[model samples]
Target: MRLTHFRHSCVLVEMSDTRVLFDPGTFSQGFEGLTGLDAIVVTHQHPDHIDPVRIGALVDANPDAQLFADPTTAAARGDRWIAAVPGHDYGIGNLIARAVGGVHAVIHPDMPTIDNTSILLGDEERIGRFYHPGDALFVPDVPVDVLGLPVNAPWCRISETIDFFRAVSPTVAVPIHDELLSPEGAAIYLARLTDMRPDGADLLRWEAEATQEF
Candidate 1:
């Protein structure tokens, strides 16, 4: 599998002859003009997770790509958007995307939690699995090969971030959902996360917009 981080939470995963992009939000870049994608998966409806302004253009460009998002976002994002319900699987090329989490993390007590489905991509033969948890910390039952870790967020703290990384224990964990942090702040967070990551798990930070094989 190949992974490309496009700033913030947006990432492009190429595996099993399929190209799938996750969370082309307001903070992400370089995904607007992508074509020939097998699927576009959105974990939640937050503006940072799904840019309402530029998403139409992206969808228009990849007309053949399947659109998948949480139920509410799917219902509102035209008829083509499919809801990623928990326990359900969506086929994308040679991989199967299984939806796990059904709710987003709470930003605050007063704010209502929304739908957030963590998508796990794996082939039928069980070769490898790539997990994108979006904005939630929900862990899947199966082992993960690569993890898109949300290192910083409004609803997340450094301790929770460390715990999540440890719990997942993926072979590789890459930081995501980090648009709010400055370079220095990101360095601090990354250092801590790297230091506390589980044994045998590598914390990798791929260069933005560049693809690297995993």
Candidate 2:
């Protein structure tokens, strides 16, 4: 599969002719040229993960492309969105996606936690399993081939991020939700994370506007 990282949590996962877009938030750019998208998987309703106006435009443009997200996100988007059922697989072209992770990570005692939906894309054999755990640290029960890892976020810590990576031990880790720091800073942190990987997993540096195949 080929992965195109625009910015932040937006990564277009393309396998052959079928393409699935994740996030497409305010922090993520490079949408002017995006066309023929098969599916858009929104992990949460946070502005950095899903921009309603921007996504509405995209959805309008790509009328055939489906919008899958958590209940909160679906509700926020009204009739245009489809809420994902946890553990239930939905077919998107050649790929099958199962929703996982329900609630968002705790920000603080006073702040309200929102809905977060992490998705796993693959078949039963897990040959091309790709997991994108939106804004939280979600550890899937099965083996993963490609993982979209959040390097930095308000609810994420480096220690927990490292632990999540260690737990999943994916063959390739794709950094996401990282518009808060410069490219240099993100690289430095990822380099350190590479050294600390438990399974010697490859930290694929997803460059903006470039398509990377794995």
Please give me the total number of clashing residue pairs in predicted model 1. Answer: 0
Evaluated with lDDT, which candidate comes out highest? 1
Give TM per candidate: 0.97, 0.94
lDDT of 2 by residue, 112-148 (tens): 9888988998766673478998877878788899998
lDDT of each: 0.90, 0.84
User: Please, what are the lDDT tens digits per residue for candidate 1 over residues 95-126?
Assistant: 99999989898889999988999999998765
Q: Give the poorly placed runs of model 1, Cα more than 4 Å off.
A: none
Candidate 1, 113: how far from true, in Å? 0.6
Instruction: Report the Cα lDDT for candidate 2.
Output: 0.84
